[model samples]
Target: MRSVLVTGGAGFIGANLVLELQNRYPDAWIVVVDDFRSGHFSNLEGFRGDCIASNVAELRLSERFRDGTFDAIFHLASITDTTDHDQLRQVRDNVESFRMLLNWASRDQTPVVYASSAATYGKAQSVMTEATDASPQNVYAFSKVQLDNLARYYHQQHPAWKIVGLRYFNVYGPREAHKGHASSMIFQLFQQMAAGKRPRIFTDGEQRRDFVYVKDVVAATLAALMAPDSRIYNIGSGASASFNQIVAGLNKALGTQLEPDYFENPYPFYQNFTEADISLARKELEYQPAFDLDRGIHDYVDWLQKERSS
Candidate 1:
């Protein structure tokens, strides 16, 4: 691959993927397209690639680059905030932006590995799989469902194009601080414990989530580029960890014991549990998670401390 494009390059997962791309493909000419809506420039501090501050829907791909310029595209841009209730804005930004990218990429038949979400499972507690129908409790998840729909439609239209969508589970790791309230529970809990305050959790703190590290998410995403056909796969740790366990992990990582302040969950649409069935991704992409909850927590905490001192 000579040229590469990452849409949400300054975002949490996007930033991690961008840095990895630089390390693995030193000679590749990389370009980033981001509007900074939910992304941060600090996340791309060490990135040695060109960045275009523009939305995917508004960016004129043809004017900037001719056909076949981008060897591969990693599309991660979207309205990531799950709590935001603006249905029109969420659907428009997330869905239309993907539509524009697909229309442009069709010219060269460029391979696109885009971000999907585990939230599509809604309240379903069963292990998430690609074949399961999307329930989409929120507009953000609804928009992602639309993106997958678009992927399917475009795949049928252009049979040879490689379009892979990765249904990312609760991804948590470095470069996610900018997400604020939408950031993972692990990061939020770590912050609270580091500050000598009790971590807060909903109710009894038994709600479990499949917290896959961002590094693993990036690995599965990059592997999708070589997929033989257009399809979607679930990317996760294949195990669910309860909120109570998260507090325990944070306590161990920070070397400070802090009990969680339990409160009732205000959101009715909240998912009580999520665990991905990653067997398909393992068989198809040959992807394996290198970090589990404890390892990921320690690594992320160390990174956070380093960033604080730096």
Candidate 2:
């Protein structure tokens, strides 16, 4: 059976991807490796797989590294906190963990498909293309950029390795539990609204993001795993919508006329008029995003409401 190792398999995106893979590739063995620092066991509640709860960097040095040779490795483990102030920790967890995974993949000659971030395109003034001129605004973006550089370096040195990096846009969906600070805006808004509280949105509701659903991301990721060449692709809806649009969708779904309370921007966060150029993914991987912003938000809100009641 084809075995695959998914680092950070308990995270929002990682957990969703693991479940999707389990359904799609039932005969294949899925090994989940996570540190559970930012991730949680609750995220893998229904997962039935060989899961090793450990730091991915430490796992690289373990006997499993030598004994088990995976057909593919999905390196999703990283310090995903964009607001984290610890630069050193971000580097240690995101960059160092990725380096260790790359080293192991290089040794085993396994294909690697890893998660990069749209944050790498910090304060994008122009259109974001697959260029190396990354202006990372935060430690998280910097760490991802560092990992992408490492992957490029390794690819140059060892052309035989298949390494693909995906720059994910704003991802949100079901199965993302209310993990307090780590939860998505959609989940947080739904929780607050369900509790008869007004959902607070940052900025004047004009701030935009290319909100891509988790299932679409999973499909793109799976496509990347099978692709022959190594390349980076932007996984998003290729469309941008204002925060007002999001709130409107939620209000429509919930049948509530709740006005969103807007707050001032805290930090000088990257408020780009963000939209993805997913032509590369469409052409290369035949990826078509199944959910638009309205549909995705409606689905999320409905799921959240049902989940909370249940």
Candidate 3:
């Protein structure tokens, strides 16, 4: 059986990816490394795999597994809380961990697929694309920019290495309850309306986002392994959805007619609009998002209700 390593396997997207990995590669030896700084144990409730509860940077990978042991390495571990403004801590944790992993994996030439972020695009005047220059507004996005740079540098030095970076758009799906405040607006709105509270949004509720479902993100991450070359690709729904539409979707899903509570936009750096240009991902990764806003909202709400009941 092949071995696969997933860092931050207990986190939101990580947990979903891990569960899917379990189903797809039943016989594969899967190991998870998470510090639980942001990840919760409940996220991995049904996951059947070896888990190392430690920081990725501190983890002694060589002592635990030999070089060439991991057939594929999915590096998802990072300080995901974008609100975190501590420049030094955020950059160190996010960038250094990947650096250590990449340096070690480079020896055996392990195929590494890592999570980048759409936040790197910041407030783009037009649709976000890989060709567009990055304008990071926060430390978290800046760290991801550094990750992309690192990946590109390594690829340049070793042309044969398969290191792929996926710039995830606004993702939402199962096993994300642990994120709490950082959870996707879809999940958060469902919760608010489920409790008979009006869904809240920024002023006018017209701010749009490319909310890609978590399953689609997983598919893109897996497809990255098949990339013909080491490169970065955007993983998103390829379409934008307004917050007002989200409220409407939630109302229909919950069988309620709660309107939105529009409040003033507080953060000056908030992105008013975001739409991913997924043409590169389409051509390179052969990725096609199966879940649109309506379908994804329905599917996610159904799962969320079941989780609450269970």
All candidates: TM-score? 0.98, 0.95, 0.98
- Report the C-alpha lDDT of model 3 over 193-281, residue by residue, as the tens digit: 99999888998998999999999988898888989989899889999999999999889889999988999987878878889999998
Model 3, which residues run further than 4 Å from truth?
A: none
The residue-by-residue lDDT of candidate 1 on 1-310, one tens digit each, is 7889999999999999999999999999899999999999999988899999999988888887764478899999998999988999999889989999999899988899999999988998688788888999989999999999999999999999999999999999999999999999998888888889999999999999999999999899999986779989999999999999999988998888788999999999999999999998899899899999999999999999999899
- Name the weakest run of 10 consecutive residues (lDDT summed) in model 3: 59-68
Cα lDDT of all candidates, in order? 0.92, 0.83, 0.91
Q: How many steric overlaps are in each model, in order?
A: 0, 0, 0
Clashing pairs in 3: none
The C-alpha stretches of model 1 lying farther than 4 A from their native spots are: none
In angstroms, give how far residue 308 of model 1 lies from its true place: 1.3
Per-model RMSD to reference:
0.9, 1.6, 1.0
What tens digits encode model 2's per-residue C-alpha lDDT throughout 72-174?
A: 8888988877889698888888888888888767876689999998888888765567773688888889999998899889999898888999999888897
| CA RMSD (A), model 3 | 1.0
